[model samples]
Target chain A: MSGAAEQAPVLQVRDLQAHFRTHYFGVNREVRAVDGVSFDVNRNEIYGLAGESSSGKTTLIKTIAGLLKPPLEMVGGSARFSFLPDWDAVGRAPPEVVRAIRWRHLSYIMQGSMNVLNPLRRIKHSFRDFAWRHLGGSKAEFDLRAAAHLERVKLDPSVLAAYPHELSGGMRQRVTIALATICKPEFIIADEPTTALDVVVQKDVLGMIRTIQQEMGSSVLFITHDMGVHAALTDRLGIMYAGRLVEDGETPEIFARPLHPYTRHLIGSLPRIGDTEQREGLEGTPPNLATPPPGCRFHPRCPLAMSVCTTTVPAMIETLSGHRVACHAVNPGMAA
Target chain B: MSALLDLDRVSKSFSRGGLFSTRRVAAVKEVSFALEADKPEIFTVIGESGSGKSTLARMILGIHTPSSGQVRLGGRDVTTYDRRAFMAEVQPIFQNPFEAFNPLKQLDRYLFMTAERFGGASGKTAAEEQADVALRQVGLSLAEIRGRFPHELSGGQLQRVAIARALVAKPRLIIADEPVSMVDASLRMSIVNLFGRLRDELGLSIVYITHDLATAYYISDRLIIMQKGVVVEQGPARAVLSAPTHPYSRQLRDAVLTPDSAGAFRAIHSRQAVATPGVSS
Candidate 1:
């Protein structure tokens, strides 16, 4: 893990910012969804990005995947992937670059599997459409490659003949996984892949993700709002809030000793099956990104908020072993 | 203590397919449970897809009539209640926060509608006040969310708004279907904690439905484990979860991922290697 961490990251995001700037009836508003966020996803590692909706986690992943559509635009920062290094150099990369990189070197397992698969088209056609071009071989070779990918994810090859609607939700997701992985991408961005799944099936899907990630040696940017899923699958975790990375550390360390008040509250609020702790809800709703709080965005909801917190944005500081936090209460330098 | 809501051998079946090939899909079969009115508590219904937990929730809410048996709300048959009265007594918070409210409409409109309909708030001002109070209960202010669209607010904020809307009616029961499933991990806890608070402070009974058991055990006082519409087990939350008697319930419990057992999650990955038959089909 340390060796991979030290190496040039497979996906290096530096101060990446994607904002939703809208003009409605002569009024202009900018939502700072992913504001000055930086992270590195190394090869063969599962980097868990945990944040609530509106935390900008989704925007961050979307920006990384080159799937950004306006009114959500890349305001600033660079998302540099090892495979797509030159793609970002020009304002618009060539179609061949995009076509070659997609699924071949970069893949995404989305929240809704239906988003990728055509409802009318059979699963085999979808596979062929996605992987056939990239495989660059005879139809039989592509078919064999697709079957091998499905087999790795523990999906039956028979699903290829069925339509997406004919298959169950879990099966469709597995097919999506198989679709995304058939080309053996170096980086995989999974955004809430199992959020819609049942508890039993969620377990199955997550297990597949872990197994495939390990076996394929692909770096995964696994994003979910469920800390439990993050704890289970991710080796390292980063907590995002108000479009910024608030904390980043080992999964176990963050779970055991969460530094940021927001992270602390988030971890404390989790309902363990056996342990029944009296959990308190965070005091206020997340700030509207169009006009976020004056200083620290989370200050309105942080129980330990001080005068400084309302005035100055706290820097994410490494307070303990690989644990970084962006909060005035936790990091002493920010305290006034 | 008599049950506030009771389902006696209740079942719901839907016929699918063409006229020539008729298929009877048993969404809920022989499901029986009771929610004590006197002892108001959050009673969770746990199941996977096709577990029939949601179908049962809809029946309790009077949104759907049971094909057989009885679903009594406060000793009165649910199907017999008038729409207004049933809605006043039981409100719902749907699974998808984005789809719950009309995209064109402001979020506050739902709150005012509930307030006017259920709270008997005579005028616009009174309804606004009622809506404000309900929002406050869910840790939100009406001023902040008054003109906001569903897309403007985060999933957590939207779900809280949904819950607050449910509270505006001051219903005896709130049927929440996967309320926090879409909300982010950090935001999910806050919503789950709110359910606990509502039960304690407002004395409101909640029919919390989800495939997630960790939150179920955290807030639920008594829970029923359901599988393909069958009640596998029903008892006190702690007792049943800690020592589940039924094999299905045990399987569901074991599938739960806790922070402590992060390393152990891999073991349960292969437990369900065989794909189970679809109950709906």
Candidate 2:
């Protein structure tokens, strides 16, 4: 927690592989949900992951959160967190160790607020159920802390008594953010937190998340398919396609000059106000993970795909300092 | 040279309570607009949940009769048309393609059924011919989707099939409710572009209802911004969005998350969160 060690990335994931192995009837198949992905979430920085659905972003999040179950198994590599030097990944960490770190060191804010809160229970009980065990104190002290935290997040303390159904979607989401940050965790993984909300609500919630992360000095791994959200919130950005990290760079750099063809397509496709240029949708669908295309998975739809990309897998290479891309077209001089 | 679709101060209210004290809730409040029969255009309705956009679409599709005023189609009250004849003139494309089609049924069956019922096809071959034509318009061929179930196709492919099904009826107007919201980024523009193409090539007026204002600006010829069942602003899509006069419309436009907006939003974080609205139906 001090000196040069503080400079290291909070989370270092290397060559990670997670696959969904299912045996339906007689056929046994493996969907390479997250194949050979690697990234670093630095301390006190918001790292954004952008990709289309079925592109393995969600699977990657689940694997990182240690929420994997039967059929979805981690096949290879490690996700090392700075907090736990003894274990390489949360998935490999034992139940006792994981329970200790679940909310104290790492927390998650999901899309559906109702899913986090028990519908039948009051907001206070839901907060108590999750945080009281982690933040053990006298019941009175804990209640005071919870109310203070809710007020800090701009909710009326009276809302603590209200049921989840009574609060609006935006308010419920704000409560979810407050609950996630109450422990003052070092890292927060927000999975499409604002996707369910409208434009007005989304902007305000994102502002709160930004403000809280800044005030708490905690790193956040923000994942969403929306480019605008990534542009508005993240410091660093990574683009995933077919379970692989295709591009990673500073958010502004990635937006200014997107290196990978898929990244280019994703950035180019976004329609904005005042701009009247026609944006053509990328052709073909995302690859089916169970039977992804050989070599580069995005080749079928990629306009800049080369002969080398069809046969050989491109290694991630730095075209510019602090910016990395894994595409044969971008780094052609490199040996295949 | 009559109006293709005319809504004259239409209003719809639903009873919300049990037997003791039932109170009427106005879902749509006196909304009015019209599309010309000869001039096909993509008319967009922009609103969030509970904004009455969907309710208005249903009334246009003849699902609900307006509580007051008139919804005239081909210069006649919408309720006056026979149900089957009404469907032949207006088809609907729902948000989720997975839910729109039966999981057990083949995708082509939906298209063929629409063709047989609305396209005046008599036999299987006749239906197939009409279905294939509609599918081809959507850049999909019958051979590729003939025996494929809804689960077998991707969300994008399934949505295209839904659009194809709508096209199969050769309807004069199509009502798409949040059609591209469930679709991925790669295919979203294609589906949105498909709407514009449907207007130009098929001469079909599309009542595209959605919350995504960016896409509404991109494809729509005319648009109305609805807030809480009221049309706060209505005009050409570009002019209204580029320079909205209404305060609510301006707020909605300002809320759009772009790179610049995100950069400029650092100040809003300092503001109190309680000032934000709590309830949106």
Candidate 3:
């Protein structure tokens, strides 16, 4: 992770930590969901975050999105979005600035687009409500721009008249994409955008995302646990474990040669189309984030564990190419 | 080879709209397949949202009554079984783990309930032991999960607990409805692999329902592809997936995003279905 200081990372997360501290009938405990993780999602680049359930991938994304609520608290570190550097600054920018930047500078496309759409309103109304104000155009012009964006994503312009319920699952997702991209935001946070769609629909949605990102040159913080999806769509990938990014690198290199034992197990377990090799699943469960295992959190289940692995946490090591991994067995020279 | 579970021309319809303008929405139309008890293979039912895969699964579990045809379990009509008998012979693993179990209640309660209700356990000790055994089968322990609520555990752990609860009944068949879709990517394989293990080791026949062709290709032995209530393709999992004869099946196979073929996936979906477009919702 060299030369991290010189460049102004679009999303600079330094020692970013999030914890789920809870009191269970007077038993106070803290699950370190995102602990001491550091990474930079560079401008106009797709940085992929991969982790299984309980690996703290979702918690990390939620923190980045400034949605820390309830037991989930940002205990330590900083998640500084280039646009929103401070917590208080969010939603407090000058009306004109916020209006101009919100849908135009930063946008998010969620897994289930239905969440963003109002079922009662026609699909076009949802777009008008969010982007119309920022678009700074006449009603006719705004409608025209929205429709053009829809066409770019291969959605029929007629979809604007139909309610969210009237459209198919795939169509609703494409509408959400159009809504997010209509403003041509420089940064887009996509959380498993195609995870819910069918195989065929997933392909179409992912392809649209790839095409639009390439054409627009917008930075995307793509979060999903599916390595296959990550490998297919992301240019760079980061592996999250117990809330920390244990590995980060080019997607192709990570898929071809994973260094972390956990990453190895994760990639090895993926079932290919024609391959029949019996793959062994990782044993034991992910540590309870509220009270995760000591030292290397993955030591209990990692195939290659040492005595040091149980006591001293491993630092993220740059082994080969641009690949960085965190594991005592894999990178033994790291000073913990 | 005798069929363990069979669906013959099964159809499910829901009446919507006003009294005069009642519209018949066919969720599952003429879907048919057979799972052999002797084979004990992972049979996959793949479909998108409106494809009626879930509806077919609910019918198999006797949760929903089919409008026409029959759903047979172990060569007996599924609808014929009363509530108690139906639950004991078949079990279901729902998609969302958080929604599958009550968030307020302890996770062990479901396990104990399953043991007492279906496993014929006599006392708390026996039921606890049975729960522990089932948990162990899924690579979990009762001690760690005994008192945890749905929120306390991760989605993968909760899903594993859901699968364990289904297994306590010792049912001949299990119907997993998008079991791993809600789970994290890394944790997905463990759950899918458990299905294969259960079939091979315990002789449990599983009807794995999912939209993910990668995991389906990885775990399933045979599969039935569904599109808007119709079985578009049905055959051995490998044969059907590798060399799909049907256009819809081929589209599905090509739409799957692998590491090497991510860039070309959209072209596969561009060729829209030439068949009549049904109501997608």
* Chain B TM-score (each prediction, in order): 0.92, 0.93, 0.92
Candidate 2 lDDT, A247-328, residue by residue in tens? 9988888989999999998888888889899989988899989889988888899899888777778888889978999998
Model 1, span B104-185: residue lDDT tens: 9998888888888887888899999999999999888999998999888878889999999988888999999989887766
CA shift of B100, model 3, Å: 2.0
Evaluate all candidate structures by whole-model CA lDDT and list the values in order. Answer: 0.82, 0.89, 0.81
lDDT of 2 by residue, B137-164 (tens): 9999999999999988889999999999
- State which candidate, 1 or 2, has the greater lDDT: 2
* Candidate numbers sorted by DockQ from highest down: 2, 1, 3
Model 1 TM-score, all chains together: 0.90
True contacts kept of each: 0.47, 0.45, 0.43
Instruction: Write model 1 residue lDDT over A188-306, tens digit each, in one string.
Output: 88998998787778888988887776656777899988777888888789999888898998888888888888888777777777787776566556777878897688888777878
Question: Could you give candidate 3's per-residue lDDT for residues A1-336 as a string of tens digits?
Answer: 233224466677878878887898998888788899888786556788888766787788777665677788887777766766544332334456555556677788988778789999998799989888777779888888888889998988899999998888889999888888887776788887877777777877887887787566567898887777887778689988877788998787888888898888888777778877776656766777756778898889887888888888899878897788888888885745
Q: In angstroms, give how far residue A319 of model 1 lies from its true place.
A: 3.8
TM-score of every model? 0.90, 0.95, 0.88
Off by over 4 Å in 1: A23-28, A87-92, A334-336, B106-161, B164-170, B184-190, B265-281
Off by over 4 Å in 3: A1-9, A19-31, A67-100, B121-133, B140-148, B262-281
Clashing pairs in 1: A225-B185
**In model 2, what are the clashing residue pairs, if there are any?**
none
DockQ of each: 0.33, 0.36, 0.29
As a whole number from 0 to 100, the lDDT of residue A300 in candidate 2 is 91
Error of 3 at A280 (Å): 1.9
